[model samples]
Target: MLLLEGTFPFVAGGVSSWVNQIIRGFPEVRFGAIFLGSRPEDYGDMRYALPDNLVHLEATYLYEPQDNPPVMPVHAAPETMPMVECVHKLFETDMKHPDCAELFAGLMDEAGPDGKVSHEVFLYSPESWEFIKKSYRSRCTDPSFVDYFWTVRHMHTPFWRLREVAVRCPQARIYHAVSTGYAGILGVLLKHRNKRPFILSEHGIYVKERKIDLYQAQWLKDNRSVFERDPSRVSYFRQLWIRFFEHLGYVTYQAADDIVALYEANRQRQLLDGAPMERTSNIPNGIDIQRFAPLRAQRSALPPPVLCLIGRVVPIKDIKTFIRAMRTVTNHLPEAEAWIAGPEDESPEYANECRELAHQLGLGDKVKFLGFQKLTELLPKVGLVVLSSISEALPLVILEGYAAGVPTLSTDVGSCRQLVFGLPGEDEAIGASGQVVRIADPEALGQAALALLTNPQAWQHASEAAVKRVEKYYSQDMMFERYGALYEKNFKWQA
Candidate 1:
């Protein structure tokens, strides 16, 4: 079973594509897929087609409002106070505390078959009220209890909802979670309840990304004025949300049977975040070389002086930075044109800002917005692909660019460096496939693009290096075989 959190179908990204690729890889093996999203309204139409091997598919939104309203006021259980206190202590203190896991186990039972602290008891018991008020008086720095009340409730509802989902999830030999958040917790619950082997493949470190989002989120209610408060003090509510995700990651880390990362760096991060090193390993993302090689035939000897950033135009992608880099590129090479190619619907506001920024920079005809073009179409025209993302995992676009006989100029993030320079062996000996620039640097990114585009000798070296590197080291055949090996070793399957 695949325990996907906001990836596949509803969203289009590297992780989503990777999930689709994995399912398609194992044609003989029947598979189950579970997709979990934050809210019902967060997604649109499915972005991917379901694989033939996918036999069971279920999707749940964590924020789906209960039809019955909040578990209503009801008779109190005697253990409610202790249960409430346990909940507070788990969040209030260190998550690694031995008691925290034990207490969470009780919460599983309480939220599960054991009725000591029923949902009603948690929602309406007098003991529950006392614990909330006590925790408020002691730890809450937020001025309004009203905001605090809703924040705590919002932070916790998904966890209970996920447990409910776990109860109904069909049996599967292995539970593989793409990222560690709600789906990770569901994996933990399934492992605890059904003793199913849980595999966690983290394409991006979930909690680290959550922290970045929470830190910038303006939706959080901050009572203090910008000038009045010290910069050291983050809004209590933002901190609360960050801690909640951190807690989920810790618990999931403890429960996972095996942990996987896209690169060695992320694998080490899993270790630092408490994943047992013994159970963790790196699985580099691979591409289908033939799928993109045909595009190379259409490539012009002198490809257009156009650079494309193929991803969502969101803050983490730093689209504005890419636009600024285009301004610099076009100024130097007047014929240069650029395309920001991906879905903008994910963040229309950010997309609008990027579009506006492009015009504001006077990149009128030189820059275009190409929404979700197939790689075959885009790869043939563009001289180089660019990734200005402030963050990434192992970006498939870089590998895809290589397979298409085009090189990428990317921010030195995630596994881009390893992919470009190759992995310190025969692969590295193949030579640098592309240029790696410092993050958010328009000047450096622009210069790198101009250098490769203006000089055919340099561009050919990079392009040849790219195709050679991808064919030798990164391919779908390798990824599929590696995952098949993992499944074979871990589960007795009817293939």
Candidate 2:
């Protein structure tokens, strides 16, 4: 069974694509899926068809209300404060506590029919009220207790919702979570319930990204009463949210039998965040060279001076920087075109902002917004593929670009630097296949793109290096074999 949060059928991002690839890659093994999303209204139609091997699929929205909270009050657990203290200590006390796993296990035992804690006791009882007030009085720096009251409720309300769905999940030999937030919590919860193997595959560190979002979040209620506050320090509520996720991540890390990351950097970060060293390993993202080899044969000897940025048109992709970079590219080669190809539905306002920037830069006909093009049709046409994302893991686009005989130019985020220059030894010996520039640097990005697009010799060398590097190290067959072995080792199932 796979527990995926905010990805798969409803969303169209890099992680969703990877999930589809993994499911389709292993045809011999039947699979089950559990999808968790923040709210029901955020998603629309399913983006991809269900794979044939998928036997069960359950989707539950965390924020949607199925029914009102029970009106009758129930007796509170006498020992609830210990579990409550264990959770709150993550924020109030030291984060790197040695017995966190034991504290987490104690917290885990406070669920379901047999557990000491109950939803009624947590939501409405006097013990819960005293705990909330005590936490606020001791820790809340802001003036508004009303906001603090709601923040505490909002932070923890998902536990019950997640537990409800987790208990119903179909029995499977092993459970895998793509990331370590809600999905991780479910994986841990399910493992506790069934005594099954739980595997965690982190494409991006969930806590770090959540911190980034929480810092910039406009929706979070801030200093409504107290206006004069230091701007540098994070708000109490924001810190609360971050700490809550941190606790969840640590708990999941402890429960996971094995943890996998796309690169070494993330694997190390997992250790820093309390993942056991013995359980963690790196398995790079891969693609099928044969699938795109035909596209390579179809491409012209010299790729046209066209660039494509294939991803969602969101702030994280930093499309504005790409549009600004285009201003520089068009200043030299007037015919050079850039295709911003991906879903704009994820963030329409951000998409509009990008279009407006393009217009302001006077890239009228020089830039085109091609929403969701067939990769085979589009990869062969562009001279180069670019990613201006402020954040990423191991981007599949770079590997895909390589397989299609096109080089990539990416911002130095995630594994892009390691990928371009290579990881070390045999991988580095494959040589630099592309350019890596600083995040949000338009000038450097523009120059790199122009160098590859305008110079035929340089572009040819990059294209050759790209194909060689992907074939040497990152390919779909390689990924399939590794994952198959992992699944077999855990389940001892012969395919």
Lowest lDDT sum, 10 consecutive residues, model 1, at 67-76
lDDT string for model 2 (96-161, tens) is 676665466557557565566667677777888888898788888877888888888777777778
TM-score for model 1? Answer: 0.95
lDDT of 1 at 477: 94
- Score every model by TM-score: 0.95, 0.95
The sequence of per-residue lDDT tens digits that candidate 1 reaches over residues 3-117 is 9998897899999999899988889888899899877787998998989899999889987767534656566577667776766676666667755654675577567535666
Pairs of residues clashing in candidate 2: 287-476
Residue 464 lDDT in candidate 2? 87
What local distance difference test score does each model get?
0.84, 0.86
